[model samples]
Target: MTLPLPRQRRTLGRTGLQVSPIGLGCSGFWGHRRFAEGAAGRVLATALEQGVNLLDTGHNYSGFNAEPRLGRLLAPLLATCPREQLVISSKGGTLTGQAGLGGTEQRDFSPAAITASCEASLRNLRLEYLDIYQLHGIGEHQITDELLGTLQRLRERGLFRHLGINTHSRGTLDWLAANPTVFDVVLLDYNLLQQDRAAHVAQLHEAGMGVLAGTVLAQGHLLPYRPRLPALSDAWYLARAWLKPSSRRLMRSASKMRRAVASIASQAPAQTAFAYVLQHPGIAAGIVGTTRTESLLQILATDPCLLDAADRARLVAVFGDGRGSPSV
Candidate 1:
């Protein structure tokens, strides 16, 4: 499928921020050392040129080096275009000081800690305020008056324009259902191999909150072609598959899709995989993580063909969509 390069932009909730259908996620990118500066520059340049405006990063991404790297690379680019051409976003609360998710992670959602993390991210990114600031993988029990109050204060102080959460907790989802207006956006894993959050995303959208879908290619598990990057290499995903129940479950689904996709369509499953999630009504952008310009180019070229019941069913059946996964 050949999508119009740089697909049309969508507004994030009511924030008045315009974002591309495909955005760059900075997780597993910009580690402190052993990453080539030239390689990252190429990817960032291509993305900005292609009109991908949203960049999602967490405070702990790449051992706390992602934001600083982005700051240096993106500063000149922002000057070339309008400063508002990019929608900068970052997450805090999980101060693991490591690149990829695993057992060594540490999480803190206290008022002072969350506040300090946001401030540090601003300094690292060298920005006045982020367009969106999310709580990195926060659980329901962590949501509280003190934490919410601190975030509210941060927004009022112009540290961040919006507050969002990256989560898969049922309890947090239920809380969002009750207080739909509290947060302005959500970052969640939404893709063909996993569709459990399909209905939840739609509900969030209907309530007027923006959605940024991550891991749209199942952590490169479903991509026909994947680039090599330290800390996010094949070994990393393999480790993820072993440690995470969801990853293990999706591995089974990816296997089925790999065998079936070639027979059904001319496009690679990676293309179809992205389209499957982009067509979901609520998503402001599909936040794809990549350090290679070629892979980013492939994502920029996705057309998101409208899917009928059978086409949808064929894809969804691989993972068995629960509660009728989001479809075109």
Candidate 2:
């Protein structure tokens, strides 16, 4: 079946890269137990056909297999299409030492590591340069002057069209804003579950930085199959068996609450979550990851016009505002 085309493109931070308002996160296409070799190419082709011009992946995803997978898939497509028509993004500052369900681990962001990672990614991606190269989350100690200098040099050399950092910390966002020219984009974890970064987002936008949102699905906890923790009551368990996490651990009361929220929100989960992020003023795009081609297609098929205030309120009630209370 044919997927719906995106209606508009958004400017990617200050890089001036125009991308589909919703982009594909390529992590799901690699390292997962269910991801097949050919699936990545199929999904990517489908995404392009559906008018998704932005594809986000990282070196750490799938033990460095993600970029290569994307390269194999995108090579043929790139040969035919003008390179400027697509936006490709990848991250460094982490490494996948092994390949398995959870073999990936974070690496330090030394200047040497950053430089080495970029060169390796270029080779893996089979591209002369990346459209965007983001520094995955790193501690303050890791964000050294040397590393920043290296990023600046990479920019000067045209190794990447733009530089960015991905983080969930407000302090990091604040720091990056203070030194705006050091980075072009900032990928943050923003969703209905967390609004603490709302103010930071506004700040970044004011500084002319691109803001891309990840974890919009909260690492799949918001899906129908999330497992219940032991703390949850039997009533909650019964109500949300379908939403159980892939791995069932000792349930927690918070698990019950989470399941309750998921149950209520599942009626229109994708619509609610996607709309919640899209409503944010500074969000250039929402980076959604999914293993299922149909799920990606569903996101593409959604009518941007359907998200309304009532839907926003329902999402707020389910996930709550940054404050401890539900926005409802």
Candidate 3:
């Protein structure tokens, strides 16, 4: 049931950079049932042909395989497309290593580690500069002065065009406010299922920072409720299954509420979920990731004309002021 890739573009926050509304997530290339290397390259090619200009990867993804693979695939294409036209982004703040029978692991962040991470990413990406270099996860303990200093130095050295933090916590936003002008973008997990930080998102946007929404599908719990087989072992899937009966009941109730809302919204359940975020004034781009190229295309193809008042009301009713458990 894969849909055709849609053609859509939006301005990436204050950078004035325009890219496809739907960006490709490279993390999918890692972990279980990894996509074949050749198939991965083809996915990028297909995405490019379909007008997806923004590609995201991280140093820790796929035990450091994602960036190099993406570099190999996009290097040749760079000559064909203007460098400024593509929004290539990668993140730091985490270290990855091979752990046993094809397993992977990661380490936390530090100032020295940030520099080293960017250097390694630069080499793996085969690029002199990155359009966006993000700090992967900035929990309270990780956001230190040294870490901020390191990122500033990287920008001073022209290693990256823009710098930002990728986090879902309010603490990260607080850190950004403390260190003004240190970041140009912020990638956070925000969706209808989790809206606890919607006000924070608005605050960041008001502060002249770009907002990139990730995990818009609430880790695939929204719409159609297709459960992958047990062997998949995806964290979100497992978490949903393990939730207490009360939580599960709430989740099921929320899902049913969302379905009803979608029915009245005249959009597919998935599209409705995405549109919920798209309608947010603060969001500059939505980062949707899929290993399946067809799924990626489907995300891009859906036309999110503005969500109407009834749609907004329905969302509020189901998700309740867009906050708490149902807002992921």
Candidate 4:
């Protein structure tokens, strides 16, 4: 049986679309080998039945297999729940043709490529129009007039309801902050371990743009259980101290911060991370890429309003004490 929808809904910027605080990142559907056939569909179904409204996917995920997999499952789900009840989002502009190790090929953000990417994504997703279409990992150098014009044309054609950019580059954030009138949403990486872009979330909100946070758990770094050790702890810690002092400090601080957050809320480390990102008033939603239905349920069960003022202050002291984050 399908579950009831959650109570909390935030407006996706000025689009007037009320989205759940937690969005399902569908990349794991076909992007990873560990996810077996029908597993992703099951998770997707659970997420929907439990009231997740936003589903985010990329065009080039799993060599373009992600959208097709999601489409196959979405077809039946849409029959039960109307398409308008869900916010379907997809991204483009990542060249999958030359996507191997140690290659000279880079992402193509040109107008022709962007248009073709969107058209192909629509076909793969088996959808009439995407709720939100984003430029995948767009950087400052890629924000050209041609690219903007192409996106505008796509919107004019009813290909997508809104346009957004998924980026963590400082230059791209600066450019977006300067030219805020172009897009409706911005997806970026913001977690307790990396708060550099935290300030930008407010900036985008002030400019009337939705801010969707990615890497909320630092890509699983904040997961509670991990391998204990294999005698490399001393060497690894020593190397970190010498090569990445800031990262070392952040790691040490994270351990203590997790305990503190758990003391306040009694949640897993990963859930605490989600609460941190979702607590930000400017944040519209926190995108979580889970491979299991249980994982999605854990996220769905989290209270977005868990973090109090003291919790926020302690978290800020951990990663915001004038220390630079290590490059990912």
In angstroms, how far off is 61's CA in candidate 4?
Answer: 1.0
Local accuracy of candidate 1 as per-residue lDDT tens digits, 1-328:
1112354888888677888998887767434445677787788778877877788888888778888888888777555565666789999988777523444468889998999999999998888899999998788778898899999999999999988998756678777867888898888878776677888889998998898888788766675544545454555446756776556556655666655554457456667778889888888889887766877887788877744457877877766644222321
- Over 1-328, each residue of candidate 2 has an lDDT whose tens digit, in order, gives 3233478888876788888888989874343334676876777778888889988988877556788888888787777777878888988888654333442245768878889989888888888899999988765456778888888898788889888888766678778878877778998877655655677788888899999998775554455554545322333323333343311221221243245445543335665566667778898999887666787887776554566667556555544533321111
Query: What's the TM for model 2?
Result: 0.81
lDDT of all predictions? 0.76, 0.70, 0.70, 0.77
lDDT of 4 by residue, 1-328 (tens): 3435688789999787889999988884334434565777788878887888889998887557778888888887666767788899999888863234332235889899999999998998889999999998777887888878888889999999999999867788888899888889999888877776777899999899999999787655455544546333234323434444333445654665555555666466667788888888899999998666776788788875666677778877766564435333
Residue pairs with backbone atoms closer than 3 Å in model 3 (clashes): 6-300, 6-301, 192-327, 193-326, 193-327, 193-328, 194-327, 194-328
TM-score versus the correct structure, for each prediction: 0.88, 0.81, 0.82, 0.85
How much RMSD separates candidate 1 from the native structure?
4.3
- Misplaced by over 4 Å in model 4 are 1-3, 97-105, 227-265, 322-328
Model 1 TM-score on a 0 to 1 scale: 0.88
Give me the candidate number with maximum lDDT. Answer: 4
User: How many residue pairs collide in each prediction?
Assistant: 0, 18, 8, 0
Off by over 4 Å in 1: 1-5, 29-32, 99-104, 224-232, 240-246, 306-309, 321-328
Over the stretch 1-328, how does candidate 3's per-residue lDDT look in tens digits?
1223345567767777776777777764332235577777767777777777788888877667888888877788776666776788999876643333232235567777888999889899888899999888667576667777878889899899888788766777777766646688998877776665678778888778888998777666665656565433355344533453323433654565557545754667767777778878788778876656667666666566756777767776666644336422
Worst-scoring 10-residue span by lDDT in model 3: 96-105
In model 1, pairs of residues that clash are none
**Error of model 2, residue 312, in angstroms:** 1.5
| Residue 270, candidate 4: alpha-carbon lDDT | 69
